[model samples]
Target: MTAGEALAAAAARLRAAGVDSPARDARILLAHAASVDAARITLIAPEDLSPDIEERFVNLVSLRAVRVPVSHLIGEREFYGRRFKVSRDVLDPRPETETLIETALAAPFGSVLDLGTGSGCILVTLLAERPQAVGTGVDISEAACLQASANAVLHGVEARADLRKSDWFDGVEGRFDLIVSNPPYLSADEMQNVQPELQQHEPRIALTDEADGLSVYRIIARDAARFLSPGGRVMVEIGWTQAQDVCAIFDAAGWQTIRVLQDLGGKDRVIQAQMAEIGN
Candidate 1:
């Protein structure tokens, strides 16, 4: 079949199975199967796909129809203009997290520490963008640490990014002028209601605290000061409804300069706070 015909068929199947952005997903999977850039797919739309490419595209579409994330199938996800390798072992980097990236880049920091760095998108992006900055990324899951490490290497930031397995700050050391996280902020109740792509394809540990979802924030608020350099700032991506509670957690912990920043969607997506400077 021609590339366009295959995409149309795949899209129809995905739509029937309730996949969001079916057409987009079909186009991307086809590009991956054909070993070409997604942007080039349009140029090939009228061409006949090779036998192997067509077969692979069919298999990818089948899996996607079953709710597997396109990133998991294609093996990479774009974040902050760079693509990072991903799998079921890591949380797919969502566009919302870019808000944290923008806020982090807004400030100048020589060192950064990323907690729960599932895919290393945040840490790697920062180091790649700043060139002179260095960062450490930690995750509780060994698999996630490996994935993050691979991503760091993929982005040519391996020399500047320290990827390791640590539950939050357990094995982390030193102080960072910037601390950032996109921690699991979904509550147990919310988890049950998330999209099938999250519930089935993504790692569960990266999606929730297995409780109220604010536990990680509480921990960060209470312990981050010990790991942050004097005058350092902490920025975190949050669920839209979580700004009030997250801000309160940081406020009560004496975090000054607390500010909530919204995403492109106008939803509260990131909260920035500063530890007490040299003097309060």
Candidate 2:
């Protein structure tokens, strides 16, 4: 089949399987299978697919039809203009989390920490941006640490990145000028309502707190002070409706000047909290 015919057939299959954005997913997977940039997919649409490309595209579409994330199938996801290697072992790097990167880059910092650093997207990106800065990324899962480590190597940030398997701040040492996270924020009920790409395919540990979904925010708010340098800041990604609750958690913990920043879509997507310098 020609590229156009193959894309139509794949999109129809994905649509029947309830995949959202069927045409887009089909086109992206086709580009991956054909070993070309997705931007060039349209340019090549009228061309005939090579036999090997056609076979690979068919397999990839089948997996996507079952709701496997395109990033998982393609082995990487772009965040903040950089592609980070991704896998089923770690949460796929998402566009929404890029808001946290933008917030973190608003200031200069000598050191950084990323808690629950699945895939190390935040920490790696920060260190890559601020080349002189060093960063430590901690995740509870060793597999996630491995995945992040690979991305650090892929992006040449491994020299400045320290990857560890730690639960939140446990066993982490040293103070940092910045700390960031995109922790699990979905409640059990909310998890049930998530798309299959999240509920069935993404790691459960990266999706929900399994309780109220605000558990990790409380931990960060309460303990981050101990690890933050004077004037240090903490930023986190939260659910759209979580601004009030997350701000309360930080406020109750004595954090200073809690601010909510919205994503490009104009929803509350990041919580930026500052730590008071010694004595005020």
Candidate 3:
């Protein structure tokens, strides 16, 4: 009936459904239903649910109980301190991917390429952070490209960001000073271990390549050099245990100066490398 009461009830329902972080999720959903901030949910006194708000809250909680990602329910996720629209069509942006953005920003580049760009969070964030830089985001899913394009517009970087529907480098052209990707790296066996929210709700093409996790990395390793400027850099997010194998892929491709960067959790999160100079 009231905001607090509705939140409490939704949290109980979610908890009973085995949802993790039920209370927190309930608060956020309640705020979305009320069209207010989550922090403001606590300030609303009892008897304020209003029939319409109550109904919306109930529906959202039910969906969340099914393990649908909150980002999809709310239609947005925060990445690199900015909100990017998300959907089942795109991979929900993860905090660990920020490592790739940080690594990209550490150096100066006038152009960037983001393969399997998904929601365009990585490419958009980079272009937003570097006003002079322009970037292209490529995704196999046309819906994902549209979502990423909307996010680019939301971040006021649409003019500098190009969204293309392409499988890896197929439709992409020209060379970039920096190329980055968080491609589908999970193996079929590893896919079985992914959380229900990801395994069931998120797009499978964005999660695993259906074989060894290294398949996408191999493709990137094989094709990235042709799309990269001489001495240009390539950065990719990798599975925690994939540093050695991914590094080997890049090495075999003749990439020079390969290095692994860790996330805040100190996991091997990103592999950065520079293309060998022309004639070298």
Residue pairs in clash, model 3: none
lDDT (tens digit, per residue) of candidate 3 on 1-280 = 7787788889999999989899999998998988998888878946578889888989999999999989989999989999889999999999999999999999899999999999999999999999999999999999999999999999999999989999899999999999999999999999988888998899999999999989999998888888888778999999999999999998998877999999999999999988657321
Candidate that beats the other on TM-score, 1 or 3, i.e. the better one: 1
Residue 119, model 3: Cα distance from true site in angstroms: 0.8
- In terms of lDDT, the poorest run of 10 residues in model 3 is 271-280
Q: Model 2, range 1-280, lDDT digits (tens) per residue?
A: 8999999999999999999999999999999999999999999989999999999999999999989999999998989899998988888888888899989999999999999998999999999999999999999999999999999999999999999999999969989999899999999999888998988878999999999999999999988888888898999999999999999999998887899999999999999999666321
Task: Count residue pairs with overlapping backbones in model 1.
Answer: 0
- Using all chains and alpha carbons, the TM-scores for the candidates as numbered come to 0.97, 0.97, 0.96
Give the backbone clash total of model 2. 0
Alpha carbon deviation, residue 10, candidate 2 (Å)? 1.2
Clashes of each: 0, 0, 0
| Weakest lDDT window of 10 consecutive positions for candidate 1 | 271-280
Q: Which run of 10 residues does model 2 get worst, by summed lDDT?
A: 271-280
